[model samples]
Target: MQLQQWAEQAASQQDWSTALQLIELAAWQEPDNPQILCRWGDWLAAAGQPEEAIAAYQAVLEFQPGCPQSIAAWAAVLNEQGQFAEAIALLDQASEQTADLWHQRAVALQSLGDWPQALTSCDSALQLDPTAAESQFLRSKLRLGLGDWSQGSPEYESRLLVFSELRDRLPSFGCPLWQGEDLTNKTLLIWGEQGYGDQIQFVRYLSVLHDRWPETPLLLLVSEPLVDLFRQLAIANLQVATQFTFETESAYDFHLPLLSLPERLGATADVIPLAQGYLPRSLQSEIRLQANPRQLQVGFVWQAGETSDRRYQWRQASKSVPLEQFLQLRLQVNHCQFWSLQVGPARQSLLQNWDWADCDLADRMHSFADTAAVLNQMDLLITVDTAIAHLAGALEIPTWLLLPKFADWRWSLTGSETPWYQSMRLYRQAIAGDWRSVFEQLQQDLNSRPY
Candidate 1:
């Protein structure tokens, strides 16, 4: 094979060193080749060198203006870096619009919170290629965000087919999937298939399922850490387990993902079942935090945990806040004790800033049950978009959830109140990647609280 072909093969196999060496030689051999330059730019971007990627794209376009492939690639990187309008302008400069260019434009528009324009662009993409999985999935998220659950819920199934780092890690059952039909003589196995927050949020559907199909055996299999927290649901005719053996597959007539319950149950935003006080109230945990009668206890989680796990590549973006922001909030208050429940990257900074000795409860937390015990005693929980937010909400604890400009679909498009958690209020970023406004709102809200 040619040098360029060898570089492409190495890049596909994730051998960055081999790929870089081969691509460098190939670029040296064919100095004017736009294809090689664009591919090299993509590789650079993937390898976390966006500036170099942009330079490589600039080289290709400088040599050959209106190069569609190079323009699209460069625009994508620009949009990912929060340059929405610039990305769009670059895409507009293209002589002809391909599906990729339209998709890139749609993404940029979506980032700008122009959902209507983004939907239009996405429709244009779907028109060009009716079977595009990525666009279809994006459409689902857009529709759901707009509260059009009927269309979005059905299209959301496209996620299972998409190529994500989390896709292959999801559990697959040999039996057929349940489709909201009669299960008179059948057993349905509901497995938690996503993050801890997802499992916590969706577990509310168990009681509803049991209530509907009184005789049908419903088994819920969640992660081991959650078994203690979820078993307290104590719903009638419900069985909660942490494991599923191959032999058990023979017993289950059908299997369904926990998140899929929404679609199967036809749950719209307006009519969310078991929205509050659904998950076991106060979650009977053996652990509890020590609280002073005179001081208001506050627990906070600044970052999502276990981000290095390849399955949660999405969390690597860091929805966390700077430690200074929380400290600033701390300065404005008096007699309100702050406990850092933050895990992952922010844990070290929190320990250095505060005496971990005072917040030994955070260190002792190992399971969702342990976190629940801390949250149970907390007067209020201030957190980013993490599983801890869901856990606190599950316990009906007062929580202020700070969200990014484009948060997940569960929070919906625009609302202070969420249907999923009555005690939780959302504080979304008005400007993308800017948390200043969010913190300002938080300060006002916290100051008004009667401590």
Candidate 2:
């Protein structure tokens, strides 16, 4: 009992190491106690030791079968580990359903690409507790993922209410959210959100907003890195701002996040505007590189950028393929010259061997535009779901995007194509964490491609 109390105190202070140690000792002392075992599982999961957490949960289920709390916690970890089907089976073992259990079932089903069933489960959860913001946010994603713009768009606002980071970072403006208010004699300031890829993907809405309300001045705020790339949008009334925040209330009449425009713009999967791409024809900045005519020019990015958000790290890792796997594709494919477009700390993987890439462009790329200039010189760009992938697709370059089995909603369930970019083709992993098959298929496609 004292050890459990000490563990709870340590956990509250975010001392996961001490908490885990204390919790493990407490569980060992009271080996038959289901409460202590469940607490140990929770601490293990919080410590990022998922497999150990599963074992702890399994120990609880061994004696106290059909425990709802243990089953829900176990399923949540399974979902995080990309074991969606197993999570669903485990959820069914619960003696009784709670809002949390229903929510876990929906999460597992959603990960398995069963949007309809997932939505039903989400509705059940919401019925149990309408105030469950996480369930509401997930339902919003499911609705939008199914291309239901009308219902999903309104529910999407829950993101602001639910996600603490997003809510905190949202620039506090005195102006109300623009929504669908008339644009005549008004100004709208739209800011970026999420990651570089999200900002790039959603910036197209600015072009739509500009054309719809050309008389109204539009301000687009983004991180400094994307300022040059977005300028290529070429809207007369649009001004891209690099500033982090707004100082005065008078910058614009109404302010909204760039993503908020999709609802007003009436865009769904059936009607993603500028699918051919909105970025201008290759800027004169395009380099005319001289290379061997016998070989095909190929650029590859094997990893996505890192994030401190522990909850999203698994998704981020799912989007990345090991550099060695891509390098091995070079040996199987014929007459294709490969270059590395990977940057950030993961770029260090290239230094492991000199023969991996013909050229590493990490140092040469200073901005998104610089990457575009390089893409202009490439015959094809193959990459994971990164900002570079979005940039390449936006530039209307021939791009092959490698995706995990459980890809982002934008990529949809299973297909070689997406509505977002006509020039981009998708190659998805048939199973989670299996890049070998993806690369094997890619190699065959490359070998069979007519020169």
Candidate 3:
């Protein structure tokens, strides 16, 4: 017990190595203790050792059969390993019914594209504990996946409570959140949230906001990287800033996150304000294309930006494809000239060997503005689920987006098209984490197309 207390203290202090060591020692001292074994499993899972964590959970379940905590924790690790069916089966066997177990079941069902079942599980969980923000958030995503945006958009507010880090980073203003209130002659500040792709996708709503409140001044607080790209909107009475420190002298009246615009305007999948492109076309760059003029000028992005957050790690891994896999497309397709639209350190590593594409823009694209300018020259854009895909979709470029089997809610389930972007075509993986099948289908489609 003393060792476990010391381990908790060490963990709270962020000394994970010492905390893990302490937990291991405590487990050794009390081998048959389910509580100790569960704690050891949690530490192992947090340490990115899912296999070891699964073993620990299995040990706990052996001693205490059908333990709700062990079952829920084990199911979560199984889901992370992409064993959704197995996770769901284990969740079904849990003797104790708890909100957490229901939530775990909901997640596993959602991953398997069982939206109706997932929503039912979410409802069951929420009925038990209405304040379960994570379940509510998942419910919102399930609703969106099922194209019930009227319900989903309103429930989406639970995200702030669900993702605590996002809530912590949010700039709080004493002003009330804008909820379709009259903004006549009043200033409204709309701030960006989440990833760069989210900012780019939702920025189109600014035009809708501007149109509604033509007389009202609109202040957009966006990320530093996107500041330059958003500046080109040039909406009357609109201002863009990278940061906002709420002060008495501030020019805004009401503040809202960019995503909340959908709920405020009562937007659904059917009415996603500005279904076509919204961004102004960038002036063509002086950079010359080295590709054959007769062939299709296609740009491709293979990976998303790297992140340390465990919540995002699995999504990033599933979405990203190896550079070697894209090289196969180069070898198979001869009608199109491929251009590397990839940015960041990953691009640098891919460009080291240097013999795949006609031109590389890794050194040139520093911001979204630069990438937008380059994307303008391409006839077609091929990319994974990344910011570049959203950028291309926003620009109204003909974009082919490659998606994993369990893709984001925005792409929805069982579709080759999204209502968000008219020019974008989705190519989804037939099996989870199988990029080879996606690429093979993509090659066939490219060959059959009249480009």
Candidate 4:
């Protein structure tokens, strides 16, 4: 059979082993064929044999020097093997040989966490082929990582158009942004986006916005559970809209995603204004009465909703743990009530164990609002870097956010505190995915305190 025919049959059958074998047979017949070598190398990499793939691709480069495809394939395998610098060097050579080389270089640099260089490559790729779909998509993602939102937002919108649901979900605003000036006589709809934690974090800016434009009709659209709590915010002209049940006719003059407030505020590493506390008055009043007479009331959220790590497939596959680690910490606290704000599957299992330190909130709670109410009542919240952490931060409740070693950038690095929340204290893992050390330090901190 023809090499192409064999390759096509193997691929169509979903037999990676057979495809690899066929590619090797072809390469053996035409040992100096750069094309065959590159194809075989790619199949090897796809079959999770990056080391072998790199060797095959290198053989191609030996015969035909400056082979861009082989160079790129070698770089990609090196990247997969965690040899970022070597991969980047290969990409540099590949990039010089082709007009679309920058696109390949960007992929290599992104893997190395070199966002700035990757952005430059993305720019070069766009300049080379402005209409290219992959160039447009990657450019947007790299720009977001670089924290360049001025251009990022428009690019994001453009990229989102590729997804029918995302495109449809976007409101027809007639404009890309709100000036905050035209709000004098119009209703401004401020709604949530992204994860629950994102919604909670950005919601704090709503109050700042309300103070900035008191005369504008502020209709805050949030998930149903947050409605009752947000209604009590009681800013002048503040109105609440929950879920899909709200009556509306897109008559608003402007709309903004709540997450965009950070961009509008020009929030930066040094400028995170940590306002001491900002929980709603009604909720505060309720929590104040429930505060224990003798102990430092620290609310605890051990596990984030399972959805938090769903996007990181490799991480999910390798290292995921339950609240058993949390139970160990609970034993160290004598007077503290270890409340479980952990939602979803983990919560049920935790309740079944019935290991909570006589804490009754787990029995009474059913939704996020209940969790929010409990947070308001507590003096401090000890939680994983989850939605509860964002909620506590937005409410300006004193919260100690626990983070994994390789944390998301929103938390930033080299800090014991968050700029977005004055009341938040950060406890991070010293090593990647090492929660035991983090938990040990937290335990010591709890022990040192007058519990």
- Stretches off by above 4 angstroms in model 2 are 1-43, 51-65, 244-250, 284-290, 448-451
For model 2 the TM-score comes to 0.87
lDDT of 1 at 301: 73
Model 2 agreement with the true structure over 43-79: per-residue lDDT tens digits: 8888889999999999999979999989989988988
Please give the distance, in angstroms, between residue 107's alpha carbon in candidate 3 and its true position after superposition.
1.1
Model 2 poorest ten-residue lDDT run: 241-250
Query: Please, what is the whole-model Cα lDDT of each candidate in the order they appear?
Result: 0.79, 0.84, 0.85, 0.66
Taking every candidate in turn, the Cα RMSD to the unseen true structure, in Å, is 2.8, 3.3, 2.4, 6.6
The TM-score of predicted model 3 comes to 0.93
lDDT per residue for candidate 1 within 9-63, as digits (tens), equals: 9999988778878887899998989888888898887877779999999999988
Q: Which tens-of-lDDT digit does each residue in 1-451 have in candidate 3? A: 9999999998888787898999899989999899989988888888888999999999999999999999999988887777789998998888889998999899888888788999999999999899999899999999987889989999999998877666875556667788889888789988898899999999998888888878888888887789879888858977787786333346677989898998998777877766689887764556666768888889988898777765557677788888888788888988888889888777776667657533677777878888888888889999989999989988899999988898888998878888899999999989887788888888898888765
In candidate 3, the residue pairs with backbone N, CA or C atoms under 3 Å apart (3 or more residues apart, or in different chains) clash, namely none
Cα error, residue 362 of model 1, in Å, equals 2.9
RMSD in angstroms, candidate 2?
3.3
Highest-lDDT candidate: 3
TM-score of each: 0.91, 0.87, 0.93, 0.67
lDDT of 4 by residue, 1-451 (tens): 3975798688677688999888888888888888888888887777777778888888988888778778867865665554667867777665344434666677666654566777788788778777655556667666654555566545654544544444565665454556445466777877766667767666666777777677878777787767766666647777777753455544566777676665565444344443554546245323323456677787776665543221233322222344787778777877665566566565666767755635535644544566667776777788876777777776777787877653554654447866668778888777655688878888888778775
Best to worst by TM-score, what's the order?
A: 3, 1, 2, 4
Please give the distance, in angstroms, between residue 287's alpha carbon in candidate 2 and its true position after superposition: 6.7
Better of 1 and 3 by lDDT: 3
